[model samples]
Target: MDPDVAMWLGSTLLTIGALAVGVTVHLIGLGRVAPTFALGLPGRRLRTDAATFALTHRAATPLTWLAAAIAAVAAVGALAAGLGTGIGEWAVLAVLSAIVLVIGLTLATWRAHTALGDDALLDDSTNGPLRPGAD
Candidate 1:
């Protein structure tokens, strides 16, 4: 097979995979299922119905979108790299895309955690805690 054609095919596959993974992650993060239950095993129960869940979902929405954006960009990069002249460029693009994927996810999770943090919830003097017993 021609190198360029092979590269393009590889890029297309990567793009599809990235999109699948990104969408899956976003759906999981935005879901209301209990984390332990999601893992398919019994574990400590958490307040899944709390206000924190809503807040976290709202906070995470943008992050998930950002992740999607990153994935799209990666896809574009892959496509462009495949069309470009050098194999070295393709390698670089692959590494960069991987880095971007990791970084985007890390930032998204971090932001969501901060937004739904105990302090953030506690600071809401009007609504107070989501659960009556929750600290």
Candidate 2:
């Protein structure tokens, strides 16, 4: 029955909703561009471009869902708070929003970096191996 709680929940819901929609749109786009990602890299190239793409797709799916869950919980809490008392709710909402946003963004970037690192690369010019794994 707190206004602050309501706002926080609302913000969490809003962030999660935004994240889900963004991810859905991204997946659709990825599917459409599958060919480009599937293309193999030129000489001295080891793995297909699809490797990174696939990795990202896989990572995003679960992460997006996790984020949605968080958002949903926040939304419910916020709604409950709204029905109670309205206090210094704005601050709570702002803080929560910022924290969640940072966490989400950090996770996304970390996934990409991890995937990239996992992708083995080779230097054709030197006929030397860069990172051993894929193509």
Candidate 3:
């Protein structure tokens, strides 16, 4: 196969991967279940099992968007440099996606903790000094 054709094919695959990620994120963000959910588990629990799921899902929105952008640029690079179909191209995009995911998760966790803290004051009279409760 011609190098140009191979490169083009690689571009196609990258585009497909990026598009897949984008559509998946949109559907999930919009409250639409991903296709994989149906095949993975029952009761749709996988999608909304955690109390922090909504928060995580919200966080995933930006990461996936960013992932697509990174992947698109990476694909173009691969296509132009004849680096398509190479691990280097895939790895670059994968690493970017991973970075985005990790940062997004970290941010989400922090945001959730801040937004939904325990907010409960325990009766620490036993541990702390008496507060005139006469206990």
Scored by TM-score, the top model is: 1
Report the number of clashing residue pairs per model. 0, 10, 0
Give one digit per residue, the lDDT tens place, for model 2 in 35-71: 2423311121212444345444444445545655565
Show model 3 residue runs off by greater than 4 Å: 34-46, 49-55, 83-135
**Candidate rank order under lDDT:** 1, 3, 2
Model 3 agreement with the true structure over 39-105: per-residue lDDT tens digits:
2112242344332233334435565566566666666665655453565565555456445544544
Q: Give the Cα-based TM-score of candidate 2 against the true structure.
A: 0.50
Instruction: Please give the distance, in angstroms, between residue 21's alpha carbon in candidate 1 and its true position after superposition.
Output: 3.8
**What do the candidate models score in CA lDDT, each in turn?**
0.56, 0.47, 0.48
Q: What C-alpha lDDT, on a 0 to 100 scale, does residue 72 get in candidate 3?
A: 64
Instruction: List residue ranges in candidate 2 displaced over 4 A.
Output: 1-16, 19-22, 25-51, 119-135
TM-score pick, better of 1 and 2: 1
Superposed by TM-score, candidate 3 places the C-alpha of residue 66 at a distance from the truth, in angstroms, of 0.4
Q: Please give the distance, in angstroms, between residue 39's alpha carbon in candidate 2 and its true position after superposition.
A: 21
**Candidate 1, residues 21-70: lDDT per residue as tens digits?**
55654444445433433421111222254445444544555665676567
